[model samples]
Target: MPVVTTPPFTISSHETPTGLLRVSLSGEFDMSVGDALSRALVDAARRPGVTRVIVDLEHTRLIDSHAVAGLVAGYEAAAAVGRGFTVVNGGGLVQQVLDVTGLSEVLCEQP
Candidate 1:
């Protein structure tokens, strides 16, 4: 029998010419990385010249309640500074959870 391990979570950010700060997340997103996510979101939103923060969850596999709280906190932080915050590329259970929680409507980018 072999023990399996999940890869450490990662957060990457880049700024677009259009004043958007794109933050991409990868790996399981749970309580373990909630604080990091929150910090990253707030930092991204507060970056000079950034008008919006787009969270890309395309590579994020799992998201827990703590993670959801972090997202909400991030949204609030961005809003306080007159910045926009939204999420994209969430699928499967991740999307379902967001939808069920009503965050999909509030935090996701509209099609």
Candidate 2:
């Protein structure tokens, strides 16, 4: 059998307001990238003064069910810590996924 490798997706985080952390996500979000995404989200949730987290998926090209699960898990974890978690600026394919899955309401978005 030949060894297989998965492509990498980009995930970056930055502080916004006094208690807000913005996580910018892009590229394909699939099984291969799930672990990395989860780890990054967990780290961001644990940061001090981060009472809110906004996951920006505007530039994301693809997302699978596993990726949605990861986002939900991250949201739950943040809520457990009394923090807010939101998904913002998603349009086109990204928006379609959230809408069809009924996650648009569950995941907050910016106007």
Candidate 3:
């Protein structure tokens, strides 16, 4: 018999003195955690005194359509409230997904 275990996933957040809410994602990100990601982004954007929300994907190993959808939803949520939203530090597969989907231009900083 064989057993399979999924990689660990986590989300952590902090706020800077300038009202920037930085949310960091660790491990894999996919449909399993899509709802959580959306909720976190929305909540962060709507928080009192938060002027912007940035999701850090530097440590994420994987991402799927659901994750992208969540990001879009978060962006929309932030925009609806006049708050800025963006994503940063995504690389490899995660970066490719965002680029191929044309979301990098929308959610990430241009270089």
- Model 1 lDDT tens row, 1-111: 012234667788888889988888888889877887777777777788999999999988889998898889889988999999999999998999899999999999888
The 10-residue segment of model 2 with minimum total lDDT is 1-10
Which residue pairs does candidate 2 place in steric collision? Answer: none
lDDT of each: 0.85, 0.80, 0.85
Which ten residues in a row are the worst by lDDT in model 1?
1-10
What are the per-residue Cα lDDT tens digits for candidate 2 across 9-106?
77877796697888888778988888777767766776788999899998788888878887887888898899989999888888888889988988
Question: What TM-score does prediction 3 earn?
Answer: 0.91
Q: On TM-score, who's better, 1 or 3? A: 3
lDDT of 3 by residue, 1-111 (tens): 012124577788888989998888888878888887777777787889989999999888988988898899889989999999999999999999999999999999888
Ranking by TM-score: 3, 1, 2
How many pairs collide in each candidate, listed in order?
0, 0, 0
TM-scores for all candidates?
0.90, 0.86, 0.91
